[model samples]
Target: MSKSYSHPYWLDVPALKGQAGQPPDGEICIIGSGLSGVSAAYWLLEKGFEDLILVDDQPEIAATFRNCGHILYGTVESMKALVALHGEEKAQKLWALSIDVCHEVRDTMQRLAIDAEYRQEGYLVMAIDAVEDREIKESIALLHKHGFDSAYVDQKELEKLGFRNVFGARFEPGSAQAHPTKFRNGLLQHCLKRGLKYYSGVSVKSVDEIQGKVRVQTERSEHWYEAAVIAANAYSPLLSRFFAEHHLVEPFRGQIICSEPLDEPIPVSIPHSFDHGYEYALRTADNRLMIGGWRNHTPHGEVGTYDIGVNPEVEQGLKDFVAKHYSFQKPLAWEHSWSGIMAASKTGFPFIGPTDSARIYTVAGYTGHGFSWAHGSAKILADVMNGDPIPPIVAEACNPRS
Candidate 1:
């Protein structure tokens, strides 16, 4: 079933429509009620900023709803690669930023008493080839030197854990996973309770500076706010030309499939991935298997497109991945399949500060690690908007103009 729009396997929960149904009439307008936007509103409210408005095209099913439920601790690249790309200090700060956000999410859910089905079961980064095997070992060594508790596993141990055709793996004990839509719903409800004015099905056409205020022009009408934050992720370019002109974010579509709950579970206990995150699979809480990210094998590489329609070739690649990696008790019956777009950052880190327009800001370009970045990045955005000082390292790494 190849449709133009995505149909994720997550539950279809109703959008959180706050006290008002009309567009925002507040001092601060958050354009895009995805995890990023909701997180921004939460942080802003925490910073004593009231009268905030959150709007979304379809808040009921934001793009994060379509992501795998993994709460990863870093970007798709290994820690070693990160250090090589941005010196040791910057890489260390970047890694700490990810860890902070991940823990904040867990703490927030716990404090709010929201059962998001979050589990700190950690993650396994398996190596599909010799090169990655070596990379994993090196990355683990670097992580340990930096006081992280990651460990490297040999192929024999991997076989014991039921993974096949892999040389070695890196196990990060601090990582975790969750129920995507469940977590989003809980967070949204928490924000609403904190005086966040949320409106659903309100898509913004453009965010422009008008009369010393930010003009959020929607399809139906225009609403003005003292300031605005563009947290739309992959869709940011569609709303503002600055992002496209600067080539800040690129949209890449990813496909995923879910299998019927198995009577006898596969030997794998936690979420795992390989090939620089081109393929990943995990057993859900309900005993079903969900896998995604075979876009690497797709004909067009799944880039520069918003359509999340499932590609048959990429779907077949995922099935083949399953057949090659594991030996199931019975033939798997895939019951659901879907896809979604991810925003890859050209600057290697998400833009999380003021843009060219003083009245407008941004926190987009998470580069497929939104769950790990949104909350913490939103904190930085809030600080910047509040005239507070942000860490110099963060200022340089996530600079919007950079």
Candidate 2:
């Protein structure tokens, strides 16, 4: 809020950042000010597209990151699922995009001077039993087939590395973590410097194609644009009839817990997942363990709606998980807890192309991997919108209709 630059790079002279004024209709509008929305805006600007408006219902920017567990840049295992559904070739492109997104975020942090506690400590994916272990082994073989580098850590090696209760793990380099809220704020500030018109508390009612252009309707006003990017994640279907009946862009509850700092560090502080990604944990900068994603606890209760409220039944399961997995000198007290809604498409990959109308594009359904996919997805959206050539695999593997 202090300042993003000596002057707003694209704002009119003497017009400050966060100024309240509407641009002429029929330009470009990005709905949702979360990671994907902001990333798309930045990429579009880099490609010389101007007159953009960023709309969100929250009063502040990057509201989603503030409520997230943590940010990690690993997608190797997540990609395996894609390969099964879409085959090897297209999945490879999506995997490349995920890794490329990680590199792009790292470089952007350094270039923009973002203070997000960025770390590239790598990722260790732990399996619960033989079933998951076999899956992990096959994933490694598949990664090898696809020319991606990863190493398997046996039980002994895992114990040596300070992990427990797993047959094996897949250690992937280039996996990174960061303070999510700071990273989002930093990106928002950087985009502001380049003249991003961000409006908060603007609830969008619908997005429809009017006369071959995208028209956005909100509670306060109406506007049109050459294109509209739906990066709202779970809220996409709610805002537009285009996605309502698709039934794939589903909203589910994702909650996280922030434990009080521990006196000593756990054997490993790198990010880890257990039980087929139903659970994930990472060490925080303050040395506390932040863990979440136990929808398996109350599987039925986790789905439907965008309510950011915690489920008490699932909360109990997470507490038991903490006591079972790690040791502490004293009883650990939970410091904070919160939940957010996330979207997932039937494809497991995000929907990332123009909709029925070429001017209307869908960019949501990140399936809980938005942090890794948003930036690259935005670049792809930018490429497609700016008439630049895009990788064909993206069109095939990530097509919204697919």
Candidate 3:
């Protein structure tokens, strides 16, 4: 799939060579070349920020997204989970802003001509039991109360729609998914054309605010910039030792699997999730059934973003669920499995603004919705970096202090 999406293996893409006598110092340095960092770099370069340095631990760009199958905006249900903690007004605001983020991802891809196979096919969230069915009903009401579009699907209706004995479900109309590898790489190539310099395979040791500048020290070199954006997400806690005490971000691992391309593609590319988003699946552009998520089954053990191999139980559960759902008498014959660490926060939203040191900014802890929120969060953070006043909606939804 090289050159199929984002420089296939990052070949021909640019990288910063600190070992080759390149200066570590820059006016602006962005840490981590994942989706969040790349997205921020794209928006920042568009706003006239140049000579920027992008660094990552991986050997290539969009490595994380490469494993992801879909990017549907599906966090409204999570907002409902947080309503008890954040209150109704705040929940509605968060819900609305999240929906906007979905639009943001689509609009940005279109504007940048990022060919990530962007498709607006919507998503299907199902509930298999009484408790989850109740949750779906409440979620629909909440979304409708806020004037968003969502429709409920009952057991009989779901059966007719190609499921057996489904309890209930909801459809999020404006949702969409993309070929993640292509999206991130496409964005990276576009940003490179606009003068974004990225360095890969550089392990960042620490980040600190010294005297007046933010210093980022990697295993091979150290650099100081006017300011820095810690876009590492889950990896932030490990890299930015100074901010770990604030306990701002916690890393969580998300594992995924791929099944053989279906002889016939599903009628539509509607992504699926249920059990409070503890499970999810989607068909890839190549018509493969890719699905994962069930960390709740191994809740305590699944924490920490380190490179822990896939849990056998969790992986097996994913295969079994897919088999049962699609009515495969035997297993679906798993094609591939993999995992990566992602950031989670006390709040479901990202910590998208300034850190304790106003000069040191960050955008992490997107939970598992990084794809849904990363671009818009990056744009908001970029707007702030350029000294533009933070818009009320952004401030309301992404205030780090909150």
Candidate 4:
């Protein structure tokens, strides 16, 4: 079963069909068509790499397109929690990279002329529980210590933002939201124009590194390349043997539902969340409610591979949440229901860079914050492939041998 976004709301973009046969031999082979893979291809093209091939089994509608499109400058998990897990320096570096990537995403969209409803209206992390409120306060303090601007807002402030049931909230002004599928499709179209060859419906079975050449086998045929990138997100572990041992990239499925266009529009475009059960609502250009999140309640059930079909329990949970939190006056008709898989690491940061196998490189384990960090990770991987100096942060984050 495949995931599908609710329709009759946001702008529609045409899908890119997958390649029918084996990919043509190229200088570089990217094994996923998600934002990270596409972004890497786009940046590589910008750096003048002509021969590139991108492969994906579900290229037209992968997890990247399925995201709620929250371009956050911070982690969905609180900063204080990350600091406790990976220490202050590592946590701060992760947070800083996310911020950098947010800026990079804006620049890329602008340069490419991709109108994704891109905005920096800020992100609100609200708390529906006492534990979350405590975490929010600590997160505010942590952000201040790391030189990032964030404010701890009380219930009154949350009410002003049209959000209720907020024990407390932390606001980060640098975050953003956008129409995800349109943005990804726009990038794909741009890549095609720039000579980035894409092969959808083609899954790479195995990759073998032999004597300066990399051989990749798909269902139908095999192709060889000089370099390769495994940017398949949650689907990456299945292709890379290195990821199997050093990384624990657990896949968590998220369900999203959209409401029919309302008579009165939701005033803002920014996303809101409470108790880590993200409930983001953004108004489309035509004024419809596109909201997603609430997998926290059934975390065990949501953990698995990339299946787009909605779980009945998760779907009902989202419906109940929308009824309680959102402002669609009448019984909101569910236009669509879909699911996307996100990879999370035990340490709560992603692995990005060359693996033990020199020919294979990867960037996965976004932990639900891939949109924010993907661009920078792609840039770093491109630089590494080009034999340039890899940044220290990239080196730290790249746990090929973890």
Candidate 5:
């Protein structure tokens, strides 16, 4: 791939630019025009909040648009690890939330008539070693016990599926994947049609609660709104002293690479990950293989930075993994490589709902699962704002105040 396009293959399409509307007054201000921000605007509009403005610093690429586009549930961690981290009860609720979000996003895509190349073929998590094999078994068992659809695939089964892996795997049914940029573009067009005033190239500097409204300070000028939501994801802390002082969210950079179409494709019918979710690869609908993840190999260097530049060492690590794991009929070279900044919340979950100020709210820090969390978080934001009842897990685990 030429070095000209520094974005993932998903973002190779034409950019969707929005018109800059009149200055903000009583309209709600949403910082960041990514999935979370756009979804928030969508749900708010659905709930009768028509006066809204979505702004982004970079109109070319929203952080969420730079991901691998797999809308799988749960985090990078397995179900067993999730149970250990937050206990069985909360973990079950969290899993349920992810499943619901998956369905919600799919329904939204269908409802809006989007041609985003969506596939509900599920996801596979391969275990590269004996330890991971055992973890996969336990994770599948836990998922099954919680009424989730999951199964363990032994090495023989994996081999039949064209995997050269040494151990078993965990297969979770009902998950889906899509063209990220296409989905974003579709929803953005819907939002814009619903009277959403969008402004690009407007970098937000700070958000402050004024006497009766919220003031959003941008590089160009300051705009006041009746309310504001900080959906800036990895850039959240940079927009507020409170989020920075409280250490709410930290930035992490993840990289991805797309290879040229193979002469003969492997039976990678669905997306799969290995090495404890540090690495993942999937054969696109067009037969090109896209793989990413290696932050573990450069943990310190990958974290605490908002830079989206490709990391050469991590890139090489991915190339080596592909060479070692799969055998294709023809030699393949990478055609595209890019990186995106992700926000890891203090607790590995997202921060949604109201902030210290009632007039100000937030929805960020999905770790690396913002695609699955955005619509659900937006629904929760709308619910809270509409004075509707929310799931107990959301109040218990996703409360911004807590």
Candidate 6:
């Protein structure tokens, strides 16, 4: 199955130069061009770090571009599961940090003047079974305990929201939706204007800790920097061999399908599933039903895979799910379909900070919530690299020493 978004809905950004160039001595060298890397670049640019290099294997499209674009304040069911594994205090702190990240994304987008079609529409996690309904209710309670604004919606309310066969639902108003590719491209453009260097299609072959600086060897040329950041999503493992020993991150494939432009929009806001494997139906400005999520149907097949091709069963499942719940007047045709690999962490939190080597920093293992958390993670990472105080929320969730 070829993994790609099934629709032509992305806001295109210019292609970046991927061939290696002379390694200008820099304050920071980031090794990914996704939201996390670009967001870090944008924040550093704001802080007056002109010397930075952003590198990626696939410059144009990757996990960040293929995201469902839901800017959520907390993890789906996995967050509560983290509470079970790590304890309530740690889980609460993690959720609060995620909320902070969501706010940071909205503020950064506004500050950068990036019109990525952002919407404040809250995310609703709908349960279709009894056990899932109980889980949703428990999660809502945990959310409130952590000072988050959330409420459990009954079947009547769920039906009013155009959801059928839903046992229950939970609503979080702090969540949002956006066009991810456009947001990433906008940040990249801003980074370019701020004098940030980027090399696309260039994979970092090796990272060597030299004298006091980090030496990054690429397929084309060798570059050196005072500090290095690995924000390459699931692909980070390929570059940072130490990542394999940590057992903190794994790659999961997410597939999506888009319906042809409808006469009228189906969902005015973002609608996702309770199981954490599906999110869909954010109406495009042009009234298209852009939807994705069905990897649970083939969980074993999706793990550790980076291919961006379409899966027929997953695609058809999306179609059936949409038709069963939402009312569409016309016969829907899928315009585009694609898949991207998302990094899942064992702790259900992102790993961001300096590694064993003082020069090597990392920001990956977002656990499928990078859209909300990436910007804040980037900001804190840039600050840490510059010898500034790390944000408290970031400090708690991300401990490279852990």
For lDDT, the strongest prediction is 5
Q: How close is candidate 6 to the true structure, as a TM-score?
A: 0.90
Which stretches in model 3 have alpha-carbon errors above 4 Å?
A: 1-23, 59-63, 74-79, 264-268, 299-301, 329-331, 392-397, 400-402
Query: Which residue pairs collide, candidate 3?
Result: 16-198, 16-199
Candidate 2 local lDDT, 142-240, one digit each (tens): 878988878888988876765556688888776888766566678878788788788766788999998877889988788889889988888888897
> For model 4, how does the per-residue alpha-carbon lDDT over 297-400 read when each residue is reduced to its tens digit?
77575777667677778778878876665544476766767777788875566777777777787777777778867776788777777788767765665453
Q: Which candidate is the best by TM-score?
A: 5
Give the poorly placed runs of model 6, Cα more than 4 Å off.
1-8, 11-25, 277-279, 299-301, 389-397, 400-402
Give the per-residue lDDT digits (tens) of candidate 1, residues 1-402.
Answer: 334224676844544554445675779999887788988998898889999888888654456878888888887779989989888788887888888889988988888887877888889898999998888888888887887789888899888877679888888888888887777778888777777877777878998887798888888888888999999999999898678788889999888888877998676768889787788778888888889988877677898998767788888888889888877767788877888888988766788887778889899888777886887788888998999776787777776463
- Tell how far residue 217 is off in model 2, in angstroms: 1.0
Candidates 2 and 4, the one with greater lDDT: 4
Error of 3 at 328 (Å): 3.7
Model 6 residue 3 lDDT?
36
Superposed by TM-score, candidate 3 places the C-alpha of residue 376 at a distance from the truth, in angstroms, of 0.8
Best to worst by TM-score, what's the order?
A: 5, 1, 4, 6, 3, 2
C-alpha RMSD between model 2 and the true structure: 6.1
Query: Residue 6 of model 5: what lDDT?
Result: 68
Badly placed stretches (over 4 Å) of model 1 are: 1-6, 12-21, 400-402
TM-score of each: 0.95, 0.89, 0.90, 0.92, 0.96, 0.90
TM-score, cand. 4 vs. native: 0.92
